[model samples]
Target: MVVYQSNSTNKRSRGFRVRSLSHFAERRVQSQKLPSHEDTYPEPGKSKVTEEKPRETRDEWVISIKDKVNKARGDVTASTWDKLCIYRVPHYLQEDDKKSYFPQTVSLGPYHHGKEHLLPMECHKWRAVNMVLEHTKKGIETYVDAMKNLEETARACYQGPICMSSNEFTEVLFLDGCFVLELFRGTKEGFTEIGYAPNDPVFAMGGLMHSIQRDMVMLENQLPLFVLDKLLELQPDTVYQPGLVAQLAVKFFAQLMPTGEELTKMDKVESVDLVGDNGELHCLDVFHRSLFKSTRTPDGKSLKKSMSSRKQQLIHCVTELKGAGVKFRRKKTDKLWDIEFKKGYLKIPKLLIHDSTKSLFSNLIAFEQCHANSSNDITSYVIFMDNLINSAEDVSYLHHCGIIEHWLGSDFEVADLFNRLCKEVVFDPRDSYLSKLSGEVNRYYSRKWNSLKATLRHKYFNNPWAYFSFSAALVLLILTLVQSFFAVYAYYKPSS
Candidate 1:
């Protein structure tokens, strides 16, 4: 559309084209101005502008959904989903207790590496690598090349994509693996034998070793066992093999065991990890698998096969169990998961609660809950213990029965440890190994005679003072009855 600018007397004199600067100025204004809602350029009905509408809020939503569907489809065939062994702890699990799931003194895997606080350990890690190369008489290339070959496999072990270059990731596996093997060897065979000084900071330092040990077992702070084993094999003439590395691990992490009893039979554990430990993912995995493994004897015979059964959440609290004549005793077994109930007796292997127990159990439970190939044994045990321990009294009773030993401040602290362990976990009650045992305990608890006898014993014979007081009352009542009977007989005879 064109508008003509005309002088007062030039109605048709200049022809319709205004050949002046005013014509150009008018055109610029038309180009710069936007058309109002009422107007459409080049006739509204004649153009496609009528059909072309602006984007609406609903259109954005549709696009977003399409993108999500595309992402979901990619996850279906993504092999990493199944191949993941080392996982970042989900936010829900780690939110409540960051200290339990996170590394403190040292960082092992890529998760916590290079953090501002964890950087001090880097120099120490380099020192460890130097020590490893010096002791094994091999160049760094031997381990570096091995890590590069296993790079893809190592990355696959993690949950998400690793954000490291090939060189960087390989170095991580190489250095971290070497440092871990050295620590394992150092802890067991002495760091002095491994060429470290008597007061070396990491291994020989008293309190620091404990912290490093705790950090080594964290969920996010682990390198793959295959990585460690590959590094182990790369070394020569060392007293290490594919199987004995697990032994070294058990010894390194011996203090993390929940029970103070001779809980781990090193003989039984040596054979189990060959089948299981080669697949043993990380340090946390070694500790987790070693806890529940109680198969094989010195003669190389199978001890007991695992029984598979659906579970029912039937175990009552300790106080309630005691009310039903149920007695608690510490079972003698290396496997902590072995809980047996029979003939009004519920026997559990001794459990020790300490300052480090919470951290260890938290990571183990988190790993079990996150890893797909993992079992619910640890989680089930935690949940079962949480159900059994309702208060300090329950802890005290279990402590008295020799089923629980704790270095914690008090029995209440021990009770709280079990109670808080399973805070944000999801467990199918049917998956608990103790379910059948729990059902039996509940059935026994329902029997009237058992409860009555238990109540009587607990009330009258619970303590020596109570027993003496009840006995005195009973004797006095009997004497009073005898005196009344004599009076009645004498009165009857006098009347006759």
Candidate 2:
């Protein structure tokens, strides 16, 4: 899928939702907060208490427990749904590749806000803040005060805690928000025009820009869009258009989008429909939306049925499907994941795989898996591709047909990329957006006549000698039939 920022990335695998992992961190927090059972029992280093108390009547114990429960309930806060969008990538996902899930250059928001490695970028953030303030002739309070007002609302957007105090948190929102805004502004209007030196390390469209662009889309490294919008509003002479930040975002990040093999250059985004309509949560959401916006979904609806079993294969892999008479063809489109199957032909949009492609898909899938309200479209697309590509041959076929393009060294690497993407994802195949489409593909693959014809074609018509032999044999049979007919006629009519 083409995910653009004013042109940029994030997204998903089919067959899995991250419900199992959502509460892993929460459960751990609860475990730490509540008293440990092991603490109730004597510790190994502590002296063991061997004395037993006199047994209480069941009713008495029940009353004591009821009192304790009442006290506990009074202490506990009632659960209410919180608006959560950004999240830390679960360890299960991070294990495969930390770079894909974690920011490498600049930290956005509070997740990796002040790590020593990321601390270097803090000054650049300040510089961006300074430049914006200087250009607008406003004090830092102009931005920080705005953040203070929206602090609680912004905090709710994050999936977990933001440990910063009121002042500290607001400062982060201002600094990071300003930096993100400047980045978008600088990218769209040219960094030099925004007061950065031509050789300014961070602002220049150079080495750091690529890393920063990739980092910006990490699930944890996103600033709230509201903050960006507010900051953008504060900036003078800014366009007053709705979703202007998102429009600029597409320009800044869209170049990273995967285009078809023939689409060697990125297209300028003329419009960004998703951000204007979907109420984008953050920059990553903008990226995520770009990948899936207005694309055809399976069955034109959400798949409601869960798979009869877990980890079910969506459809036979590419090689097996071909063996079952399915023909692969490239659809003329730039958006990947738009696949269609008809009359044993599977037409898929050409997908160009750049280095950022994996990270983009990883983050987007993580987003869908984490966000309850989000659609599973991205996740399904990745899982669908993973299911189709089993080995190098499958990759080769797709590449040969111009459906899959990659900058990787070989088809093996492309195959491995798809094969590894859906690992450790907890998915119920039938629940995916691609589930209905997969079922249709499987049904087509199941036909005995198609399989028999495919086998015959593969075996006999595959080589010139075999085709020639079959042709000669058919010709001889036709001649013999003619001779037999003549003889029979002569005998019956006595040479009339």
lDDT of 2 by residue, 69-124 (tens): 98878645532225578888889888969889888889988888788888888889
lDDT value for candidate 2?
0.79
* Strongest candidate by TM-score: 2
Q: In model 2, how many backbone clashes occur?
A: 24
TM-score of each: 0.77, 0.79
Residue ranges of candidate 2 with Cα displaced over 4 Å: 1-80, 259-271, 277-280, 294-309, 463-469, 491-496
For model 2, what is the error of residue 86's alpha carbon versus the real structure, in angstroms, after optimal superposition? 1.0
* Tens digit per residue, CA lDDT, model 1, 176-197: 8888888888887777876888
Q: Candidate 2: lDDT of 392?
A: 97
Worst 10 residues of 2 by lDDT: 6-15
Deviating ranges (above 4 Å) for candidate 1: 1-78, 263-280, 294-314, 465-496
